[model samples]
Target chain A: MYPANKYYVKGFVMSSYSERLNEYISMVNNELDRLLPEQRIPQQVVIDAMRYSLLSGGKRIRAVLVLEFCRMCGGDVAAALPIACAVEMLHCYSLIHDDLPCMDDDDLRRGRPSCHIAFGEANALLAGDGLLTLAFETILSSRNLAPEQIVKAAGVLSKAAGYQGMVGGQTVDLQNEGKPISGETLEYIHALKTGALIRAAVQMGCITAKADEGLCSGADEYAEKIGLSFQIIDDILDIVGFAQEMGKPVGSDRNNDKTTFATLYGVDKARQIVKTLNDEAKALLKRFPKANEFIYEFTDSLTSRTC
Target chain B: MYPANKYYVKGFVMSSYSERLNEYISMVNNELDRLLPEQRIPQQVVIDAMRYSLLSGGKRIRAVLVLEFCRMCGGDVAAALPIACAVEMLHCYSLIHDDLPCMDDDDLRRGRPSCHIAFGEANALLAGDGLLTLAFETILSSRNLAPEQIVKAAGVLSKAAGYQGMVGGQTVDLQNEGKPISGETLEYIHALKTGALIRAAVQMGCITAKADEGLCSGADEYAEKIGLSFQIIDDILDIVGFAQEMGKPVGSDRNNDKTTFATLYGVDKARQIVKTLNDEAKALLKRFPKANEFIYEFTDSLTSRTC
Candidate 1:
């Protein structure tokens, strides 16, 4: 029923998506590298550890979401770049801490040694702390946003990073480890852990663009749906995708006894669920009929990926 | 020659000092209790862990520094209370993490079991992360400071907390564990690990007050000298003071093979160094001739404390 090989279109069209995504990702990597201090006494290793994971290949999807959402809402992409960068920094920190020996104990991240493995456990812990603090510093230092906007954006970011959001989700996840996971429990974890920051990314863009409350709320709702959908799809791909395709070991989750949407609902059912979420997200865009091409293309590309 | 009964007199004066410090401590404790979220999760132990150390209580010297510096610079102490509270929050986080199993691995903090001991290791780690993030949130949410002030304060705080500062110092300390002491190395650790945040606390006060550059610079210099002096005295006290007087175990530095001012300079030399630093810090107050009673009293009190 799906459009087979839609993403297989040759050179020119595929290059457009690849080029745009790569360009933005490059900008983010450059900005992050530039912002972090190069020479600090006695512990350059900590910074290097942070940069290792931060610069190690990711799609930079969160940043792309920020940039596209801002542009769609008639905001300047340049103005949203700091928030975009900050989102990724926060995400990288979560990954670093989650991979620690006392946490998930994963030695590999993005197909290489995790922060703790590279820099030792203490440094890894500090690197996570450093990155998380730097994320706030990045947002606070944004000259593009108004002071009020900065404060509001900071509030959004902190709430997403803190107890009511990602950390709380991790706590719950850790508690539920090796336990029988219910569908509701899975939704709660994904909603807070992954969805909170995604929602914040869109909201930050809208706030920076000075969009109206209604527009911001609509974008937030859209982000929330797509965020969960993205994670569900990721879970499915982890099961079905090969190690080479996913760039990491498969069935790792099964070994970890982690419950995922694919485990709970089966592959076909999960795919249908993502379709429903994608449709709902697109429905929210009706308010912004003049939305930029980036938003439409990015949102469309979400579930279209094979891995 | 030193006064024959000076130690006794100092002890008597310290009792009064303790009472006053306790009053401020109670105020901060109340503010902190109100600020932290009540435990709703099954992890009441996590909240208990955070509260145990938070309420176990120290001198609250950092918060006092923030408050007194603001007061000395002509800002309302009440207005600066949130950031004052924040400094303590950040300090508490550092202490908790420092005592973690993989870190300092201490069982006692302020005469009670460390957070990790009271609440599992994972919970202690989370508590530290929560407190650190909460510190930034508190400063960002400060209603009294202007947006510029908030941003600037956040920058100062982040720099103090980042790789160039506390985290860097911590990484070095960890790497140097069970290693020999060096004067220069100890100096570097003290400056970043403790001195950075203390300097930031004073700077934060000046920023909030919108104090002039000369006044701010003067206060910063004073804070820097006193911060180092405080650490030196702490090292000295660790050697000389009783466990009950000091609140935590003494000889922790020696036991850990950590180089400290006392170990490097000996008791008499360390004492002399603190005196010199205290005098230098006091001399900076000449620039602020109209400084408040609290500033004079606070600086004077730092040198005379038994713990």
Candidate 2:
């Protein structure tokens, strides 16, 4: 999951960048909690089911990426919060459905009972649907953003979550479960399944900032590289990371006979490819002459993570 | 399901309205077909499965309502087509998910295989997810609509599809299944499950026309009453209508021990309630000052049926 002790030493350094990222995550979580209220409903069970998987505690990477990218593009973080919350909501929906008996059929999610396991299968399905609809609601609730910006942002999100992006990726993933997939096909699957949302995150930031089209396209390219690299590293972690450390079952992919980068290409080759992609991602950011420090540090932190 | 012999006379006379409705449905189907291209990909089977359900014949009542309501409110039908298409997409998603093996688990829909039965369980689930995501895509594609109108329409659709609407109704319906339900509870379920989308259709029409809030709200009230009345009449039909007339099994509600209006209030009382609600719906529209012929005819058509 990480490159040896690099993150260990970085953690010991108490860097200002790390502190700021932590602060941003905290704020995003606070906003998310406020937005998804569990106390206002008559059926406490349904609300609890929603909160269970929602608050199970992941890295909050999507939300942070949205906020940090907006900040790096010289946009107000406050204006980006709704989109950030939306990104997480979309992510949560994916996870909820992924854990369904018809899908991944996993009993545990984030070391707790999956939504379907906690609530009934029916409620889990509704909870996921609710969250998906709520994501659009959050984006539409961006009262602070310009109407044009909101439209653009909604477009990005819809494309990412729709047939061409995450759902398409998932469709391909499910179809190719027991079959041997070519390297190219696997890459296409990962690009849609995982890379699309990440790309949208960067584009959302630029659009929210009302950045020029050239810069927006540049950020997209950068996001594309980093997103694929992130997935490749995740594939590697499935093989080497411990279950306790990852908070998810290790080697579940291998057990399911699912296609992964490590399965198609050896670990060393996958690692080398991710490194090359990382370099390309950094190079793409060169077009932004006045890039913020957080951008560089965030990119570095992503490629250098250890679990 | 129309009453026998009644169709022989009225069908010929109402052919013009049916033709207009068919033209509108054809436009929606064409748009959906164009959006979902049939190509051989790994996910083609799942895409086809979703297309099968979508293309299967139905009344397209929601889309027609959107178009007619827009026309009645003095808006271009062309401008409302995207929102109209969106309502169908949302409705299609609900049907696909509702037919899942974990949900309703029906073998047939619209005289064809259900999504799960045609596709595998996983792909069926993903197909539903894909359809839901695509609903937003369809709505967001309304680039011709003004930004404020787009925002308003999106808000209305989202609210109708979310917790306070369809999902909540489904949850309550699931919980109340096979149990004795009060007339009020049944009404509540029908209102949220069916009425919400019906109300949204009228609201979308008014907002797209940039009509005053009073007019929109009045139309929505009109829609809500009719929507509930529609469902109550449906329950009445399920108990008394024949399989040949309805094109599906009848008395399945009693066999399934479902607590529908007829089960809760007796068939005669349910029919009477439908009449009352239809009257109430027509009364609400009196506030519109000048009613179009379509509005009057549509409202009259709802409760006047004798299947």
Candidate 3:
């Protein structure tokens, strides 16, 4: 299950983060296929389109967080699969809608035509809607989780994904697209738009495991630090990364006139912010000695990744 | 509280269905206002648009079904309010998406500008997504319902709304527009699109009430009959009822060149179909004497009214 790339630092080989990520991605991708409707049903096109948008390559960072945090908290990773998959669905839903005609209107996703381009806009719209609904459906129908925890997980995911969360953040992002926006506003936008779900992914894992208060707080703080770092690094990568490396065109933010960390504070400051966030995240992870290894490694790999 | 309008038939003056419907509408609307995010939040625009469409005005027919059915099954209607509100949210989400620019492209809904018209299409789209997510979040958050029942209800609502349900139905409806459609195809479309949620509402009440198997089957039968009847009456009303009465313009079906029962069969035949469906619904309702009274009266109001 190891990815071919091995991280080498100062001559000692690091346990390859790519290998662990790929392993989790394969696991999550399978569950997602099982969770989504297959093509035999009526309106098979919708299911096909839904699968198309979801199965296309993404790093599966949220899924890994759910699993790794569950492992950290002594929860069954198998039982946490549904919650892990649900976060990915939420992520894909946002991408599908964000690329719509009236929205960012992007033609590419993962170097492929976006859902709206591959399927018609209307179907893409429904596909996004279907995925969001299915996220709950998957959790509600999950085989291993307790009912109370299922409800808790649903609340966490939805609160992060709903109007006051990702949807709300996207609204602000859309409204301020071409217009000048403050760093405070941008922080607010990404916190919900991207960070909210990241935070939820870790929280859902803690809930699934029934982790103690201290561990839960640690996970939350860890998630927030990495969440901010993730977005800042994403902003950095889009400017300098090649299309082949990033799996999509570079400088999309500039093309779309989006204000990111790079635009506001310069790349050096943004990189410095990412480094600071990484240190803070690792410090938070220190609370759980047994579970922090994968997480710390994961965070380190995230900041240093070219894509 | 009894409505002033009395239905005089066979020497009995049945309480006014309008008064009962109005009563439930008021309660549901208040809760809906409470359930949706307030304008003070950062994504105030998304919440504002969501409330504008949901609060504008509709019969709240689906919401009433949940309460009445719960009451009939001897369950607490107050406890059922969350599920009731959830169904309406799902219904509203579909309407918003169905009226989008690439879909039906309708400017009006309930005699006012649709969500896409009032808000821009992108915001309208997000509003629909936000409501759909909120529906699950509301159910998962319901304090009155048991966790097990919440899970069951989520499965029911999502299945009825997802690819095999309303979304699937709408897909067919969109594809078949402007083309000659068979009666079977049309039935398939409406069954998923309209009948699914209508059926889900009744089933939800049954589940909430913890009704026995026979009663659940009876509720299902009752819902199917009424659901079909509702559409037939709607098709019939468009050709004959006043726009003022219906709250939206009439002849929209003909204007859009979409096929319906009235279009495929003669108007007289469509009216007969409504009569037959109403009779069948009443027959199924006979299984529950206490609950059937309001449902029967409600069905009568539905068929005989100009609106």
Those runs of model 1 whose alpha carbons end farther than 4 Å from true positions after fitting are A1-15, A305-307, B1-23, B42-45
Q: How would you encode candidate 3's per-residue C-alpha lDDT over B183-283 as one tens digit per residue?
A: 99988988999999999999998888888999999999999988888888888888888887776778988888878898899789998888888888888
Q: What are the runs in model 2 whose C-alpha is more than 4 Å off?
A: A1-15, A40-43, B1-15, B244-248, B287-290, B304-306
Query: Number of the top candidate by lDDT?
Result: 3
DockQ of 1: 0.52
Model 2: per-residue lDDT, tens digit, B175-265? 7778888877887887878999999988998887788878888888888888988898778888888766554577777887998888788
Name the weakest run of 10 consecutive residues (lDDT summed) in model 2 chain A.
A1-10
Q: A1-307, model 3: which lDDT tens digit per residue?
A: 2112421111103346566667677888877877774767568888888999999978899988998888788877778888999999989989999989899888888888999899899899888988888887888888888999998899899899988789988999998988778999999999989999999999999998899999999999999989988998888888877877776688988887889988898888899999999999898887875554556778898898633
Looking at candidate 1, what is the lDDT of residue B302? 83
Candidate 1: residue pairs that collide: none
Candidate 3 residue B170 C-alpha distance from true site, Å: 0.7
lDDT of 1: 0.80
Fraction of true contacts kept, per model? 0.59, 0.58, 0.84
Grade the docking of candidate 2: medium
